[model samples]
Target: MKQKLWDHQLRARELKREALRKYGSTVCVSPCGSGKGTMIADDAIGAVSKGHTVQISVYRRILVEQIAERLQLNGIRYSVQMPDLPDKPWAIRDQHADVIVSSRDTMAAILRNGGEVRRSDLHIIDECHGFETLGYQTINKAVQPRWLLGYTATPVRPDGMGLSNRVFKSMVEAAKIEELIEKGMIVPVEVYVPVKTAKRRRSGLKISANGDPIQQWMSHAYGLRTVTFCSNIAESKMVRSEFVANGIAAEHVDANTPREEREAIFTRLLLRETLVVCNVGIADVGWDFPALECVQLLTKCGSPIAYWQKTGRVARNYLDEQKSRGVLLDHSAAMAEHGWPNLSPLWELSDREPIQKRQQERFGESAPSDAKPIICNKCGRGSIGLRNCPCGNPLFRDSQEKPETAGENLSLIGDAAEFAVGKKNYQKEWTNILYMAANHPTGSKSFAWAASIFKNKFHDWPEKFSVTPTVPFDERKRSIVEVYPQFMRRREAV
Candidate 1:
C-alpha cells in the first residue's frame, strides 16, 4: 500500500523535481516530524517504478533500518548494507536490488575497498547536514547518480560552511514551522529558560549553572514523557540518577550503550514505563517518539543546527487529548542564544561567515542582536518581540529611570504612619513582596531574602503574618522588585 502525501509534501515533490531538472542535485529542508522519510520513500518508489535503481545513504545503521521499514511498507523491494551483523531473512545483501538502503560508512568502505558499486538513477542522502564530510564526498564520486537528493531538518552546518557549489547546487524548502503548527502537522512549543545565567568552561563552551533540573522538570513538565539532552556521558548519567532519586523513572543511554539494551530502554520509554530518558547524542537525530511532551536541554548548543534539532524532539504531535503542545525547559540558555525554535532565518545556498564575524558585522557584538529573548518573571516563559507575555504580564515598562535610582526613590504605597496604623494592610503588602521575590528571574530568592525586604520596609519581621506568597496587584510593588535592583542589592547586603 502506498502512503498518501500531505499537500505540503506534494508541493515539495514538485519543487524537488524542478530543482533536480535545473541543478541536477538539491537539498530539501523541512521541519522534523514533517514526514521527510515519506517523501524519500515516495521518490525511491517513483524511481523504482520506472525501472531505475535507487540508493539511500544514511549516517547511522539505525536510520538504514528505519528507511528500510518505510520502503517495505510502501511495497518497494530493497536490500540493506550495514557494517556488521549476520544476514537476516528480511535484510539480505543484494547488489542488484532496485533500492539499496545503506549506511554512509559502509558505502564509503565499499568504494574504498574496490568492492561492487551499483549505479543508481536516484541517490538520497538522509541527515544531509553532514553532506560536507569526506565520506559522503567519496560516495558521491563513486556512485555519481543521475539525480541526487539530500534531506534534513537543518540544512546549515555547525562550522558555517556552505553546501551550494560543493555538492548540492540548489535548495528546496518545505513548510515553515508556523505553517506546520497551524496545519496540525507539528505541535507548538512553549519554551522556558531558568532564571540563572550559564557558566563558561575553560574551553569557552557555556554550561548551565541554573537551578536544579529535577526541580524545574517537576514544576513545569511533571509526569510528562520527556527527553533530556545532556552535555556528556557523565552529565547524562548524573541527570538520570537525579531523576530516579526524585522518584521519577528515567534511563540513560549514550553511544557506548549496546544496541539491544538501547532498544529495550527505548521500548520502555514508548510504553510509558519510563518517564524520562537522559541521552547524549543518541536521541539528537532521526529518533522519533511522538508522545514526548517535554524537552530539557541541559547541554549548551553552540550551533543553531544542534539547537533546532534538540528542541525538535518534542515538536511531534501526540494523540493524547491532554497533550496539546510541547514544553522546552532550556537550562543551558540555548533559547536565549539562538532565539525561538519557530523563527526561521533566511536560508541560502551560499557560504556562511563565522558566527563571531557575522555577529560583529551585523550587531557589533558577539551575541545575537535580533530576537533577544526576555523571560517573563511571572510564569518564567521565554518569548521575543512581544509587549506582554502569554501569561498576561507586562514584559517591559515605560519608565526611563535607572534601576538604582528607581529603587532609591520609590517607597511603599502608604506612609510609615499609615503602615503602622493598619497591620492587616501591612501583612498583605508583605505577601506581595514575597511573591515577587519567589518569581525573580535570578532563580527564586530565599524566604530570608524576602523577610529582609519586609523588615526594611516595615521596620520589623513579618513573623505574625502568613508566609504564603501571592501576586501583587499594585503596579508599583511589582515594578519596585522587578525593575529596581535595590531590593536584590539590599538582600545581598543583609
Candidate 2:
C-alpha cells in the first residue's frame, strides 16, 4: 500500500485516537485545504482494525468519492452507501466494509422515519456546520453511535444556532489557514477589492443598493479566470450572461442539470479550457479546480459560514505560488454587516481593517471613464435604474446570452467511436458549465425516502424532483443520451 499520511493527517489521527478513547465523541473544527479527508480515512482504518464499522457522512455527492479514493489508497476496503451509488441500498450491509460514506441529507431522511444503525458504529459528520439548521436537528437526535466525530471549517451559522455541544464534545483539533500556507499546504492569498457603484431607482440590485458588487466584480473581468457565486439559480444565470456580454466565456451550474453534464464541465475547468463558472449552491463543497484563481462573491450569503465555504473553493494550493492570493469581490452587503476578515481563529478579525472606498480606489485600477452602463438585457434596468423587482430578478430587458447556448452540449449521448468518458473529463470540464449538476449520494434508495420526508419540509419544488446521475455525463455520454446532431456531424466525417 502507499504511505499516504501527511503531518497534519498524522496529527488528526493522534487526536481521533484520543477523542474516541476518552470522550467517545468529538468535534474537530478545521479550515479548508487542511486534508480533513486524509484524517477521516486514517481514523476509519483504525476503527475497522478494531472491529468497528465506520460511517462517514458529508453534505455533497462528490465528497463520498473523494473520501473513498483516499480510503482505497490507504489499502482500506470500503463501500459507498448512497442513493446514487451503483449498488443497491445497503447491498454491503451484512458484508460490512471498513467504511461506508454517505451524504448528510440522505442520512437525515433515513433517520427521519427509521433506519438501522448499531450502537458500536462510528459516525463521522463532514461539513458539520450544516447540522446547525433545523432539518438536521431531527437527524442529529436519531443518531445512535458508538462514537461521533463532527468536522467543519466553520461551525457557527449566521442564524446564531450552533451544532449541539453534545455531538462535538467541544474538543476541536485544527490548524489555521496561514499555518497551512507556511507548511506549504495552502498558498498565501493576495486580496483585491474593487470600488462599487450605487444602485439607482430603475437599476437592478446587483450587489446592494449602494454597493454595486455586481458591477465591481464584472469590471475586473478583463479576460481573467474567475468564478462568481450567487444566491440563487436565476441570479447565477443572469450574472453569467452579464459576463458573457462583457466578453468572458462564462458558464453557470445549478442542481437542476443532469449528472453527466456536471461531470464534463468540471473536467473542462481543470484543463483551463474554460474561463468563468458561476454557481448557486453546488460548487461550495468537494469540487476542486486548481485553475481557479479569482472568486467573485457577488451574492449576500446570510452567514460568514457560507462566505468562507465559497472562498475555500479557490483556496487550494495548486503549486502555482504566483497565483497565491484570492480576490474577494464583496459587492454584496457583507462589508456593512459582518465586516472584513470575518470570524477566523487563524487570523483575528481585528487584525485587518475593512477596506474603505478611498483605500480601494488607490490600490487597484480605477473604473473606466466611459465605462458602458450595464443595462439588464432582460429588464432594461440601467446602472442608473431602480432596485430589483418584487420577483427578486432585475426588471430589465431580456438577457442576450441564452442559458442553453452559454453551455456547451452537455447531453452525453453519442456513438461510442467519437466520444470518450473518464474521471478527468468529468471533474475538469462538466462541473463548471451552466446546466450541469451532480447528485449527492446517501444510498441508492434513500432519495425516495428523503424526497418523501422532505417534500413538505423544504422549499424545493416537487416538480423538479427526478433521478440524479452518479457519474459524469461525458464518461458515458454516448451510453446515456442520444448524440446531438452538432457532434454527430463530426463523428460522421471522422
Candidate 3:
C-alpha cells in the first residue's frame, strides 16, 4: 500500500507544479514535521514514473541516508553519492537508477576531483535555505537541471536575507504553524520563561553549569523527554554532566562524536532509557524524535531561523497520551527576542537588508513590541494575550511585587489592574452577571446594562464568552452582589 498525502501536501504539489511550469524553479516553504520528506518522495516517484531522472541534494550525510531509506521503502530504485564505506550492490555509480541522492560536500568533492556527475531532469534541494552557499551554487551550476525545487521550513537566512529572485524565481508556502496545530497535524506548545533569569546576562562563548536549567526543567517538565541546545561542545558536555549529577539520565553529542556512539545515545533516548540529550549544532536539523516533549534553550539565538529550528524539535506530535502538548523552556530568554514560534510572520521571497536595519525600521532599537511575551509571576510560564497561564495562575498580580533579578531590567506583561482574573474565572463571572441581569426587574434593558458592566470590568467585549448564563449561589452570589453596584457605577460613568 502507498502512503497518502495530506490535503495541504497535495495543494503544495499542485502549486509547485504550476510554479515550476511558469518559473522553471521554485522553493516550497512549510513548517517542520509537515511531511517534506513524504512530498519529496512523492514528487520523485512521479517524475520517475514519467521516465525522468531526479537528483536529491542535501547538506548532511544523515539526510542522504534518510532519503535513501524513504526511496527504498517506496520501492524506488536509487543511487547514493556519499564518501567512504562500500556502496550497495544496486547503488553503483554507473547503474541507471530512478533517482540519485547526494550530499553537497560529496558532489563538490566529485567536481573538484575532475569527475562528472550525471545531470538529471529534475533537481530537489532539501534545507534549501542554504542555497546561497558556495557548495549548492556549484552543484546547481554543474547539474543545470531542467527544473529546480527546493524545500525548507524557513525561507529566510540567518542574516535576514531572502532566497527569491536570486536562485529560485518563486516560492510556494504550505499551511502555517497555527493551522497545523488546529488541524491536529502537530502539537501545540506552551512556553515558559523565568522572570529573574531573563534579566541575567549570558556569555555567548561559554555556558556555566549553574544548575538553573535543570532546576527549571525539574519544576516545569520533570522526567519528560527533552533535548537541550547548548552553545558549544564544552558547554553541552558540562550540561550533560550536570544532569547526571542531578540524578537525571542525560547524554551529550557533537559533530565530532563517532557515528556509532551517537547512534547508541540516540537509541537510548528513543527507548526512554535516557531522559535528556544535550548537544551543540548536531540536533538542529536532520534529527527527528517525535516523542520529545521539551526543548530547553541554553544558548541565546539572535537569528530567527535558528530559534525557530531549535524550537521546532518539540513541536512534532507523539502517540503517547502524556505527550499532549510540547513545552519550551527558554533559559536563554530567546523568546523575548524571537517571539512565539507558532505565530506566522510575513515571509517574502525577495532579498532583505541586514537584520539590524530591518529591526531598526520595524522597531526602534529594541525587539518588536508586539512580539513581547508576558511572564506568569507565580509559575514563570510565558504567554501572550492570555489572561491565565497554562499552570492556572493569573497573569496579573500585585504590581509592587517585583521579581528578583540580576542587573538588567525586568520585562513584565502589564500592570496588575489590566487583567484582574483568569480567563476561565472571568468567563464564569460574566456568565453569572448575564444571568442576574436577564432575571433583573429592568427586563430587556438589563442585558445592555450587563454588557456595559462586563466591558468595564474586563476591558473587552463579552461576546467571546459562553452564552449559557450560569447562576452563582452561596458565597459566589454575595461576591457578585457586592461588585454589582461598582459595575453599575462604572457603567453609569460611561
Candidate 4:
C-alpha cells in the first residue's frame, strides 16, 4: 500500500521531527485509534534512510512484532533481538537497517545488566502512558536513550504525577477526540444511560444489571452488540455472567487470558457470532473490529481520556455508509459521573429519536427523589434509596424513611464513613473510588497509592495506623498533582 498520512498525522509527525531536532527528548500525544503504530513505523523508516540507529521501546511483545511487520512492509530492514537471539548484533550496526524494536522491560533488564545503547541513536517510547509508573520510570531512566520520542493516547500522568513536561522537552503534537471525529475518521456515538432501579451495592458503585456502572442518561434497550468496560477482571466477569444469565451473548477478556483464546474470541466477534465483548486493560490498542456498534462501561477508571477510549472502540468509522450509528450503553452513574466523549456528534443528528430517546422523554425531565437514594446501606451502595433489591432483599426499604427511621440512620453512617475514608485518602484512594463509581478499567497501584495516602493524611480514618506508599508519584510536585485532578473532578461529576 502506498504511504499517506492523514492531515493530523502529517502535522504530528512533522512536529515530532522538529522536536527531535530541537530537543533530545520529545513527546507526542494523540487520541486512541489515531494510527500511532503507523506513525512510529513511518518515523523509523525516515530515520533509517538518514543512517541513524533507532531503538524503539514498547511495553509488550505483540507491539514488537507489530512494529517490525510495519517496518518490513515499508521496505525498512530490521531484525528481532528478543530472547532467542539477545547476542545478535544491532540490526542497524551492519548498515543493513537503522531501527531496532524491543520491549521496555527487556531493555531495562539489559541496561541494568550493563548493556549500552548507541549514543547517537534515537529512542522512541510507544504507548508512553505505561511510563506513568515507577518501574517504568526506573527502566526509562536506566535505558537513557540520547534522543527520546514519547507517544501516548494521553499526555497527562494519571497518578497525580507531573510527568507531562519532564518526559519530553514539550508536547510536539496534541489531538483531541473531537478533532478526530470532525474528520469522519471516528463515528459519533449516542450515549444511553439506563435508569437503574436496582439497589446500589457499594458506596460509590452504581452499575447496571450487567455490573456496568450506572450513570445519568444510561440505557440498555439498544440490544446486544454492545461493548462494556468494567473496573476489574472480577467486574468484567460479573458483567459477562449477568449478560449470559440474561440470555444476551457475551464474552469477557482481561490481561491474563491466553493469547490463542483472546484471538479466537476476537475472531468470533468479527464474525458477529457474539452479542457483547467485555474488555479490561487489553483493548486499548491494535484492536480492530468494525461490527462493534455498541459500547458498555462495566469497569471504573480514573481518566476521562480512558473512558472515551473504551467507548471509542465501537465508535470507529466502519467505512460503510450503511452502518448504523454506534451506541454507548453507559452505566447511569458513569454517564452522569464522567460524561460522554466530546467527539460524539449525537446532538447533531435529529432525523429520528431511537427507542431510548422516546423512553427518556416519558421518564420526565428530572430523575425523581425515590430514584436518587442518599445511600444504599445493605451493600454499601451509595445514592440508592427506595429501590428494589435485584436479589430481592426482604430488608429493602422504600427510601421514604421518617425522621427517626433506622434505615436512614444506617445509610447516613455508611455514607459518612465512605465520605470520611474518601476524603482522607482523596489523593490515592480517589482513582479506585472513581473506578468503582464510574466503572472504568484500572490497576492495583492506584488502590495502593490511595490507601497509603489515607494512612499518612488521615491516620484516624482507618482502624489501625500504617503508612506504606507504593506509587512513585506520591512525591511528585504540586504542578503534577494539579494536572489530573481538575479533569478527574469533571469526570467524577459527569
Compared to the true structure, candidate 2 yields what TM-score?
A: 0.61
lDDT of 1 by residue, 314-345 (tens): 88887654344677777755554554555444
- Compared with the true structure, model 1 gives a TM-score of 0.72
Q: For model 3, how does the per-residue alpha-carbon lDDT over 229-254 read when each residue is reduced to its tens digit?
A: 99889989998999898778899998
| Alpha-carbon local distance difference test for all models | 0.67, 0.51, 0.68, 0.52
Q: Once superposed on the true structure, which residue ranges of model 1 sit more than 4 Å away at CA?
A: 73-75, 83-95, 109-114, 195-207, 320-322, 354-393, 397-494
- Candidate 4 residue runs with Cα over 4 Å from true position: 84-96, 105-120, 160-162, 194-224, 285-290, 320-324, 335-339, 344-494
- Candidate 1: residue 447 lDDT (0-100): 56
The TM-score of candidate 3 is 0.72
TM-score of each: 0.72, 0.61, 0.72, 0.59
Comparing 2 with 4 on lDDT, the higher-scoring candidate is: 4
lDDT string, candidate 2, 250-323, tens digits: 78888887888977776666554566788887777556665576677767665656766777766676664344
- What are the per-residue Cα lDDT tens digits for candidate 4 across 75-160? 77775647654332232223354677877767777767887643436777876756656255665565556678877654444432
